[model samples]
Target: MSAGAPGGGSLDPVPEPTGGIEADVRRLAEYIGGTERRLAALPPVPDRAPHDRDRAVAVHVRARRARRAFLARHTETVYGVLTDGLTRPVRLADLVYEAADRFPGLVPTRAQMAAERRFVQAEKEGREIDQGIFCGAVLRSPTAGRHLVETMLRPTPRARTLLDGFRTEGRIELDTVYLERRGVAGHIEFRNAARLNAEDDRLIADLETAVDLVLLDDVIKVGVLRGGTVDHPKYRGRRVFSAGVNLTDLRDGRISFVEFLLGRELGYVNKMLRGLLTAPSPGDGRERSVGKPWIGAVDTFAIGGGMQLLLVLDHVIAEENAYLSLPAAEEGIVPGLGNLRLTRLTGARLARQVVLGGRRIAATEPEARYVCDTVVPAEDMDGAVDRAVEALRAPAVSANRHMLTVAEEPLDLYRAYLAEFAVVQAERTYAPDVLAKVERRWQERERRRAARGSVR
Candidate 1:
């Protein structure tokens, strides 16, 4: 009873395949028939197609599958390679040597190059980031501009992620935005350390949107006279009725200081000033329109271009114990920006005396007529600035506008602005003749000292 099925036919287990052979055979045949049809559905190869090429096709198919899988896992690396290939190849040796030469590992990466190129392109394009807080409009009160302030989504580093991807945002021109930040009461032209650049001419031509308040901060002072080097950033510009404040250079010892100032580090600031003076803020209805001048907190040495920044401002606040110097003359280089500014503020004779003398004048020196305003202790600097700002702010708007317009009446100021490049050309010629030898001598001494120290 246990071994036998109900009818005893299946008592002995069938030794054959468990699946029905006939059914399985039918299914197999159908699968084969389908496969045959699929194969036949393909377009026939031309007689001209090479026989070896068919082997190539199989290899390609296999490679494509493998590649697809590989790319899925290593997408970042693959993309990096693709980007590297698309760009001009930079030899590892060349990059390494460049790193070794001065700034180790500071070689621009592909991404950095791309960023720089985008920055350059943005400058080339007319996409202006309107950081000018004034925009040729003044607020009724100190915080009034804040209420009216509506930032345009420009491609600055801060605003980039806030708006779009890291694309270019054209050259910037400094406007009242500077003054608004400095807490100035009235409109004055301002430029910060950010706006100094080597290619100022091109930037001016393409990026000049309007001209109004020109603003620049004298953050550092570097001068050489009589066998001494005065290197610092902060300097007193023109202070009319207040204790002067000083702008100091915080990043003086590093070698990258020069490149950083002229390159991306300071390019935006340079653009800001260029844009403002080139294109002043439009005047308000029945009133003078432009942003007021103000100096925010400054850090870092303002070398040649930085020193020259004093000429742009009408007033200054110098912090106590700040160093001011112009050593470009000693280095066989012309102080391009400083020369222009000096020529404008002082007569040609005084300008030459101050600049060509190549000496660092003290901020409080009474004998040197270079300082425009009174000097105050660093502690009293801010209070002085506040008083000056209040005084300027209280003036009738129309009167302030008239004064600014009149300030530009001098032929020297107008000419300097018009022919800004005269200083540049002069620098190219004078820098080598006068300054290069001095710089080389300094460089050699430093090298020798470094070598001796290394031996020890």
Candidate 2:
């Protein structure tokens, strides 16, 4: 939705302008520190089968070799990149030049050297990030089939104690009331499992929640829901909205479980934000500014879309013991949401490594510094999220929306992200090898899910 008319003097009411870049930077720094500490605090994740270090190394080497071969064949035309005034890009060129610059001891063949040079040039002249505007939204998925919307409301002593047990970025309000509805009347309770998911619905069913938050004039949040019922699903023809589910558990092999983590279920988040912005609240009839929300919860296999969902949100709360794997590259699948968020938030180099490498990036690992927000103790995750939610709620809505604009829009990151998706689709449709790998991966995942008793 559009803001309250451009020249309306409404912007100052929001804290966006007040925070400035320094404020944003400070916030980012705190968040990053939190992320690092969280990772450091976690217990080590259990290793999976075929987890042999040597074998994994061999696979990586093979992948690198393939990449070099590909470069050898096509370096001059597409790979040589150019950047402006960036030392990293320039240094890359020097490396390539040294490797090939008519030196006697150069290991790579002339063709390979030429490819490296091209890639370096492209890197030098690549896209730049400008502190432009950023905007986006969070979506929550509803239960499908026989399942319905459920929520926990009102804090219980046990819930409060559990919430107070951790160090978190937000406030913790335990047990609030949990409510749910099907085709009939809805129910609300204070039980922990107020929001529950049956094992069987973890596969395909594909229920979704969508919201659309934008930063045109300022941040505007709108949400639309289709699948799950609400706490009071009867507010102004809609139920008075309450915070949705705080997903925690999931069976390992369910693809839908991964899909849910990716926040694919919340595909409608953007849509919802849009709707909210379109509606007007009776204020002083003066202009108003808004900011986006920071949200996160525990995710177990936030691979694909699940990871992307995290990218969209400014803050994330991940369980240290949880498995976070992304095999998009291995499967020749383009990481749509994940790449978009990573590139914008983390930058090109790290984002490329994470996306192109197409391997798992563990939160506890040194290399995971750039990707994760906080690697928290698994049992303490619910408490941590509670605090995170509380802190996020403390911010004025206007300021949140404005910052969202800054995060989402700067450097035209989203534009490039959309471009990547186009590239992926073209490859899938035209590149037989890539298409085959993607299809194979899809089928393999399906098989694994079935073996794990997934209905898919």
Candidate 3:
């Protein structure tokens, strides 16, 4: 049998090589060299602004269709080459590099953002947003790493399914939270306005669920967390971003201390930081990030737990009148993950002052700039958010976000601090001293309310 021929008879003597393995290797080298030369010769992709929203939508539709076809044919090979049993970060970086090499301009840019807005408007008018085009850019774009795709490939957990159901038929009807989707942005509003938008157990669960839905939705690229207007007669039509945890529930023993800690740590805070993951199956506790960017729209106040939650967001746009504080020290508890994340934002000394001293940080203060990306007048909030969302929708935004998070606050650091926070917060929640302090604060609030004739 000839050496180059397949299915030679076993008894046949081995034939001399007709340009054997070396020749095959040389051929591969030549092919690669030719491909590289061709790629290098190609001109850079041109940039164009859509004349209008409809034109933008058409551009996205065509690009997404092309991307989907490409991925359908190549995804398995890409996954095998980039993500088999690799550590998440390495896998992600390699995938980004590879995608950028293989498919330039695959990631949607500003054009896609305009298209998404049009798509969202159509959906509101009873047209279905095309799922086929929703995540194609994510795969084609080098900005989204393989870790995100791998996470999506896993089966959706039942808990997550239930949470998603809360927004069935394009509307979320929870009493404590208001959820709305605008183009590629998801808005989650804390709706307990009568209590100054303070988070109670139910509100915590609902808010967590809302965040999960945002993470799960492939079409949503950014999420905005804001608060609703105050419902009290005196404060009617006025904004109250959040007053933090519902101290009344804590004082009256209406909420479980441990459950509150878990809900906040895992449900809200962790979900924002690490993204959502299904309950780990036995022997598989590996966590995956949801990979969605979050924006905080602080209108009036973000106090205590509210302030702590802001640490998890990718960006913050606070109203000029907004104020933030972490007063857990006064209440005899460590602020949830505040020490860890706050120190990174503000220096250790400033973090200590804010957490320990219960210093209220006005939005206009230079210190507030450490936490918030921008502080705009309340009237400009809508415009500011629009600009911020547009900025976030850029092609490389996801890659930039991932690299920034990994470098600035690695996942391991967050996990370690959260572990300590869960245990310490649970113990401190019901401590006699802590309870006494909370009760005293509650009484003081009541006295002030009575003195004001319950105006506030």
TM-score winner between candidates 1 and 2: 2
Report the Cα lDDT for candidate 2: 0.33
Model 2 CA deviation exceeding 4 Å by range: 1-276, 279-292, 367-369, 407-431, 438-456
Would you list the C-alpha lDDT of every candidate in the order shown? 0.31, 0.33, 0.60
Q: Kindly list the per-residue Cα lDDT of model 3 for residues 169-227, writing each as its tens digit.
A: 44475779888878788888888978889878878767766777777777778888888
Steric clashes per prediction = 60, 76, 0
* Model 1 C-alpha lDDT per residue in residues 58-174, reported as the tens digit of each score: 322332233223323333332233235223222222322332232211122233333333422112111010001111111111221111111110122322232222112212334
TM-score of each: 0.38, 0.39, 0.61
Of the two candidates 1 and 2, the one with more favorable lDDT, higher being better, is: 2
Order by TM-score, highest first: 3, 2, 1
Model 3 TM-score is: 0.61
**Candidate 2: TM-score?**
0.39
Off by over 4 Å in 1: 1-289, 295-303, 367-370, 395-402, 405-435, 438-456
lDDT preference between candidates 2 and 3, better one? 3
Between candidates 1 and 3, the TM-score winner = 3
